[model samples]
Target: MGGDPVTHGGGAWRAKWWTQGEEPGTTGQWGVWESLGACDGGGGDGGDEEPPAGGFVVSEAQFNQFFPNRNPFYTYSGLVAALDSFPAFATTGSETVQRREAAAFLANVSHETGGLVHIVEQNTANYPHYCDTSQPYGCPAGHDQYYGRGPIQLSWNFNYKAAGDSLGIDLLHNPSLVQNDPAVAWRTALWYWNTQSGPGTMTGHAAMVNGVGFGESIRSINGAIECDGGNPAQVQSRVDKYRNFTGQLGVDPGGNLYC
Candidate 1:
């Protein structure tokens, strides 16, 4: 529901890409991934940390429950790629804060991908609109190829380039990797969570780490259409899921559950 549904206008306007003959300016959020470096790096053994109270935020069995009839191809092992995601999602915080960040991340991702049942965009119409010919790379995978993919449904040419650059994958050329490789899909979600602040809002990670509460996160992910005087139902969906997941994790869902 972010840049994914680009025709929604809000996301394209929020996206930093320049239209043909249009002047470009800094979005402030640009270059945030300069150091993220191709999304590669360390990955520890899954389930390394001892479970916090109330067990883990998301266990394989519970995840299966969340995604009834989820694609069997995307196994729990794929979700395990997120074993190292907390550090990036939380960007180095306390253990409790990390737990909160993880819950918030998974909750929002669930909403984005429909509890992980959808590996790619359901509304395929928006696929072609993601291309920006004006970009230097020019939507390498072709127009319509950048439709929402991965856990967070990352969309837009610049976004794919950024995520690819950060994750060390060539998303610009091979956008299918998000759907093809489940671990890559989850990592791309984390890449977005840890990096993108979304139009006019703080990064979801910042929203959680700064104690700004869950509403800020909603604002961060889809605020343009779902914040303040925007759609309340959509906002409530995210809040309800966050509350549910937090409750399951034994952590308070924090205040300001709506944008």
Candidate 2:
């Protein structure tokens, strides 16, 4: 907490950096998480099981180099689970592909969590508005307080439920877990990364794994407002971090860096 943020796995996406918090405007402090869980010791050459050989595109030192005062919410185990959950991240045959995927993914996460400076959303006014009463799940956490959490700052009861269901947790009922448990918090981000086609595009996982490029990833995470003609600064900000991360990892930032 004192030294540079606890960047356990390594590092990205859609929110803005306007307030030093919130991508799409969400931010908060990183919190303590539950104990670490089972993790594979030996990394593999295949993309199905391994966790990107060197774990992430950059080492802990390199990550700190980019986000100097980043938060410590993202845990190593949390990142590993992301790889395991979506083996395609490391299953590709090319190391460039692996590095690009890892780098691109984390780059996007940095934007969402505000370089890890924010955990829960910063705009308190919109907390209660996240609840979509139309959703059958409703807002179990309360009418308000779902203004994003975790690396991706996942918001809404439906999203919490979806992420929780995939990870075998009850995020809808215990949304706090995303802020309390590091693994759970990261899992939510990964779930969205590997699954949801945010805003109405392909999943970030698909964009990188299929070589669709980092720009597509932005389209996936917050394309609705940040992509296309929504905001150029946000897109470039994400690209800058991605370029920095890939460089630190000794990889190219790839083309199509914007949505």
Against the true structure, whose lDDT is highest?
Answer: 2
Residue 92 lDDT (model 2): 65
- Compose the digit string of candidate 1's lDDT tens values, residues 151-210: 789899998899889878899999988889888888788788878888746788888888
TM-scores, each model vs. reference:
0.74, 0.75
- Candidate 1, number of clashes: 9
Over all chains combined, what TM-score does candidate 2 have? 0.75
Runs of candidate 2 with Cα error greater than 4 angstroms are 1-57
The 0-to-1 C-alpha lDDT of every candidate, in the order given, reads 0.67, 0.68
**Candidate 2's residue-wise lDDT over 56-99, tens digit each?**
44334444455666776665556666556655664464666767
Candidate 1 lands at a TM-score of 0.74
- Per-candidate RMSD, Å: 17.9, 14.2
How does residue 171 of candidate 1 score in lDDT?
90
